[model samples]
Target: MRRLFILLLLVLSCSSKDTLPDITVKDIEGREVKLSDYKGKKTVIYVWSRTCAGHTEDLKKLSRLVNEYPDYRIISYAVAMDIKDVQQSYQQIGIKPNFITLIDPSVKFNDYFPITFLPSTYLFDSKGKLIASYAGLPEHL
Candidate 1:
């Protein structure tokens, strides 16, 4: 029981903060990207995995949001997945959003962001502060 309490304490302390880790993912063209690249701009970080119908619908929805809100700087990034899978996910779903797609093949994001569910999204405001974070697809369009 004592060990369990300590483990729980560690886990709770690890994930206490909501701010995203300073992680950079690469685009399809192999450009090293940092989260702070677009300072003073809002960013939408989408963490999706590629598989049979895995978060495909959510991607499409986000694509629509990108299209609808062109004025807002929206960046949809694929986390915990490879470039191939990230590209394939878009191709397989036939979704062409007005946002940039990125890759994190080594599942490095999972270490920082506890993304147990697919289609997890993080909304960062103009100051690069994490404004809102959602797990799974948000019902509000």
Candidate 2:
């Protein structure tokens, strides 16, 4: 019975990561953006928190990648986990990022895309399928 339960749990975990969740989140500009909207094009999403150490550096690196790849849809998802003041956090970092930064106060997609580490990035193909997932700053496009 225990063996069967373990196998079920494993399958459930694998099933959840098989695809990206379709959800709408608001960008810093207050524009409603759907995760599926980036379909038919390659998209890279960076889920980050202001409280993470060395996050400013990671944002700088990601910002550069964004500029380097103008054709690819790059997003910077700012999660509100353990965050007290969002504006103050950015101000303290002093790194003004130039990318499409989205805010998820409730972290609605945390279950689909668990943030195991700071500055986690998820890459999706043109078909909106998850191709890769990284735990730190992505150095390449």
State how far residue 66 of model 2 sits from its true place (Å). Answer: 1.8
List, residue by residue over 1-141, the lDDT tens digit for candidate 2: 999999999998866353656777776767788766777878888888866776777777766787788777787788874323445566676766677777777887686777788778888887778889888766775
Taken over the whole model, the C-alpha lDDT of each candidate is 0.69, 0.74
lDDT of 1 by residue, 1-141 (tens): 999999999998865254445567798777888655755666677777665234777777776777776655666667667777677767878976667777877766676666777768777676666777788756652
| lDDT for 103 (candidate 2) | 75
Q: Which candidate achieves the best TM-score against the true structure? A: 2
* Poorest lDDT segment (10 consecutive residues) of candidate 2: 81-90
- How does candidate 2 score on lDDT? 0.74
Give me the displacement of residue 124 in model 2, in angstroms: 0.7
